[model samples]
Each structure stands twice: as structure tokens, then as C-alpha cells.
Target: MTELAVMGPKESEFVDRMGLYYERLGGTRTMGRMYAWLMICDPPHQSLTELAGELGVSKTAISTVARQLESGGMIERVPAPGRQHHYRIVSGGWAQVLQVRLVEVRNLVETLDLGLAVLDDSLPEQRARLEETRDFFAFSNLDGMELLKRWEEHRKNQD
Candidate 1:
């Protein structure tokens, strides 16, 4: 009776769609379903056994996925009353995810810089293209970090 007992068709459909979206993000389909479910689950926190039953996945699957999500700063693990661990979505701006994005953008800029350094100066056309790429990545990293800062400010204002 503590469990959902039965998930509605619409809910299942939503989870399925979320799973697909997560798959596009380089994660397993079931992990996506688990995330979507956690976002809307009535009680907001659930034990591994509960999640396993709700997700129709093995406990090991839940553990693996939850650990991965946890490492990514997406989900959090907490202590349950029954000595088991509970899982829930980490609230707020997802600064860690944004940090990862910024790092990727920085790497892109670095790669572009390296290309500019190694490319032949005689090939004006190639040099120009690399310069353009370098400029774009540099701008992208700056813009992305600025946007993240604005987001933090917005969230702070809301608080």
C-alpha cells in the first residue's frame, strides 16, 4: 500500500517520454525514467526498493543510475528511516551541470587556440577559418558563463 500500487497510463507515458529525452542526453533510458519520476513523485523522496518497483527495474540498476546521477549533482541520496537510502532531485539552478557545460566550452576554445597555433600562416583561408572558430568559442564560453551568473542572480532574487 505504501507503493504507488499502480501508475496511471498518462504518468507511464510521461516517464517513457522523459526516458527518451534522457537517452538523447547520453544516459540510459531507465535512468531518464527514474529522474522524471522523481521530479513528480508525490512524496518527493523514495527508497531504492520503492524506486526499483516503480521503475520496474532491478535494484542494482537503480543503484547504478542513482550513483551516476548523484555524481553529476542531479540527484541526491539521503538516509531513510528504515536504514535504507532515499533518493531525490537536487533542487535549484543545477550549478554543477552548468559548470560542466562551461568546462566543455572552455575546452572547445582551447582546441581552437591550438588549431590556430599549429595551422600554416601561408594558408590565409584556413587561418581565417580557424580564427573565426576561435572567436566563436571564446565568445560562447564568455556568454555561457555570463548567462550562468545571471541565472544565479535570478535564483537569489527569488529566494
Candidate 2:
């Protein structure tokens, strides 16, 4: 068995909590734990072998989550020496994730509109339900865009 990286009790708890959080969000527990570890790990970047060992999982699992995270803009593969690939949390990755979610919200609203179109006026109650859901998402998307814009401005000023 590969030796695992030593983490204090608090750090271990934090990693587990993050794993649960991501799992609740429809992601794998390992994905969140690995991301949390990378965020607080001393080196701030880790190879697949290192991550697998630290998380007590297989390298293949780490590799799969790494690809998922990279595609989702949550983390990035970094250039490193040797054949082993290293990864780190992308700077502003959370913001990028929110941006992607905003797009998804837009898509949901569009889908709801399609559903509404298929229903007849006689189905008032059903139409009201769809309309309410669609309106909520539409409003959220508008507010989310403004929030992102303000966040960008705040970040710029902080620099």
C-alpha cells in the first residue's frame, strides 16, 4: 500500500466535509476531497499518484476526476517535470463554476419555455407551475450575471 500523506485531524475533517458538500452537489466525494486537499496542501499542486495516495484511492479514479474537474473549469492540469501530470485548483475557479451554472440556468429557462409552449390554455394550473419555475430561474440568471460583474469589478479593484 502507498503511504498516505499525514494530515492533522482538523484537516482530515475539512476534507471529509468538502467531500460531502460536493457529493450533495451531484459530484463524487473524491472530487471534492481532492480539491480541498489541493487547496490546502503545502505544495498547492499534486500529481495523480500523490492525490490517490493522499486520498486513499486509486490513481485511475483520481485521473477520472481530474479530467472531470478540468473540463468543468474547477481545476487545471499544470506543466511539471517528468511523465507525471500535476494539477492545481484554477485561480478563480469558483467564479468560473458559477458562470457555467448561470449558463445552465439559462438553458433551464429555455427548456421551461418549450414545456410551456406545449401546454394548452385550459391547463392553467400546470402552466402556472411551469411559469413560476421558469420565472424564478429567469430572475436568478439576471441577478447572477450582475453578481458576477460586480465580483469581477471587486477583484480588479483589489489588484
Model number with the top lDDT: 2
Predicted candidate 1 versus true structure: per-residue lDDT over 31-74, tens digit per residue: 89999899888678888888899889999999999999898899
Question: Candidate 1 deviates by what RMSD?
Answer: 2.0
Relative to the true structure, candidate 2 reaches a TM of 0.91
lDDT of 2: 0.93
Q: What TM value does model 1 have?
A: 0.89
Residue 56, candidate 2: C-alpha displacement in angstroms: 0.8
- Residue-level lDDT of model 2, residues 1-159, one tens digit each, is 333457789999999999999999999999999999998986778899999988899999999999999999889999988899999998889899999999999999999999999999999999999999999999999999999999999999999
Checking candidate 1 for backbone clashes, the offending pairs are: none
